[model samples]
Target: MATFQRHRAFPWLLLLPQLAIVAIFFFWPAFQALRRSFYVQDAFGLGERFVGLSNYVAVLTSALWQQALVNTLLFSASVALGAMSIALLLATLADRVLRGAKGYRTLLIWPYAVAPAAAGVLWLFLFDPSLGIISRALGSLGIHWNQRLNGGQAMLLVIIASVWQQMSYNFIFFLAGLQSIPASLLESAAIDGAGPWRRFWTITFPLLSPTTFFLLVMNTIYAFFETFGTIDTTTGGGPNNATTTLVYKIYQDGIVGLDLGGSSAQSVILMVLVGLLTLIQFRYVERRVQYY
Candidate 1:
């Protein structure tokens, strides 16, 4: 709300574009969804009638919603942990590389720039049961790699694709965090008979805590919201809805099933859950993060 003393409207003018964008794209839709969550309409869309908390009650009590919730938790956690771990390992190796480092870094970061849907398609091609290269290779090894028929295989395939899509983003942050670390502390540790593992555990890891904490939050959000496109393209939440996440469920209800009220209620629940999660992380998780 602060403004210039001489021209009070200048700061407001400067913020107008961003404010307008947020209102149009985020706030307005959210308000509409909130208003709609409490109402129900006939199949033909003749009229909508407010039904108290019927939609919310139905959604919460539904067995499908429960399953989606479980799947979402598993998928989000797997993607966040898997992506961050793989990215950290790659960043560590790249940091130690003395030759062709730029090329290595560029190749590693290329996946981050790939569109989520495109990345999903790439993996889908690689994991297709009959025609996929990797799938055929697995079949040759006596492993039936049919994601289309196997629920576990479908979930695993989605997790791998999601992790690969997110790894580059984590790599960039982790690499920056690694490079920001002062070399002196590491050298002193080495001089005192500390090995790479000990130095990482005691010195490097602590310094990277802030970056790790940040990536944890960002990755959680990404896994929750941004993976929708990837899931849609790859599995379409298929194989008996095994890979169907909460967000995907929302889409299934709203767009596919045409259950506007239920979908809106689910959306509100999702929004609250994500907001609560972020608040919890900042309130509690950040306590362990070392900024200095």
Candidate 2:
């Protein structure tokens, strides 16, 4: 009995380091943010006073906060849908090619390896109004392109940059999902008079539901937090706050505006939003995920 108990506890012993890291790095900071959300503090941290829920109230009532919420939703939805759709298409095409499949996959996955900030800067250079190659090309076509001054254009540029950075990740997962699908099932569907499109709809798509659902959750979270670098480098949430997301707003409030209490409250709210969204996805969306 002692030996058996020792073996069981050994696994947990192995997990201790990881658990300690999480507690120290993630839980500790989250706890600090939560505590700070309830207190007002000076910019220099020379003084602090408990203010209860006032910070939350201020954040909820602010028009800028509401605008950031709307912008975040739009950005998240656009990035998730655009990235997943393009990745799926590319994965599907890549899977069909019999020659140079590894080479094609290598090229497809290279974008995901690029740092998000670097990717954003690259796109910004291509779209910069003053000297961008694309901007000049657009001028030649009589379409004025200035993302800095145009709210819609700024939003579009950030979304495109975010999507481009994330596409390769989705592609790798989708390609793996596609390859995992049994060939016999598709062969049987084709034998039963289903056309290529029909077989894909009936067999391929249904089998891929699991991958799609997983990517949906992951992409939503990525858009919420990981796209901060992209937005910062591309637009800085500028041009009348057209592309200001909640995370960016938190940075602006805490670092730039020096409103620590309000920023903490916003961070807490964002944490709650992420939790709720994740719960809703797992509760409703997971039911249809069709895991094999």
Q: Which candidate is the best by lDDT?
A: 2
Q: Residues 141-246, candidate 1, lDDT per residue (tens digit)?
A: 9999999899899999999999998999999999999999999999999999999999999999999999999999999999999999899999999888999999
How many backbone clashes are present in model 2?
0
Estimate the TM-score of every prediction: 0.96, 0.97
- Deviation from native of the Cα of residue 191 in model 1, angstroms: 0.7
- Backbone clash numbers for all candidates listed: 0, 0
Cα error, candidate 2, residue 121 (Å) = 0.8
Check candidate 1 and list the clashing pairs. Answer: none
Ten contiguous residues with the weakest lDDT in model 2: 1-10
Q: How high is the lDDT of residue 73 in model 1?
A: 94
TM-score: model 1 vs. ground truth: 0.96
Q: Where in model 2 is the C-alpha error above 4 Å? A: 6-9
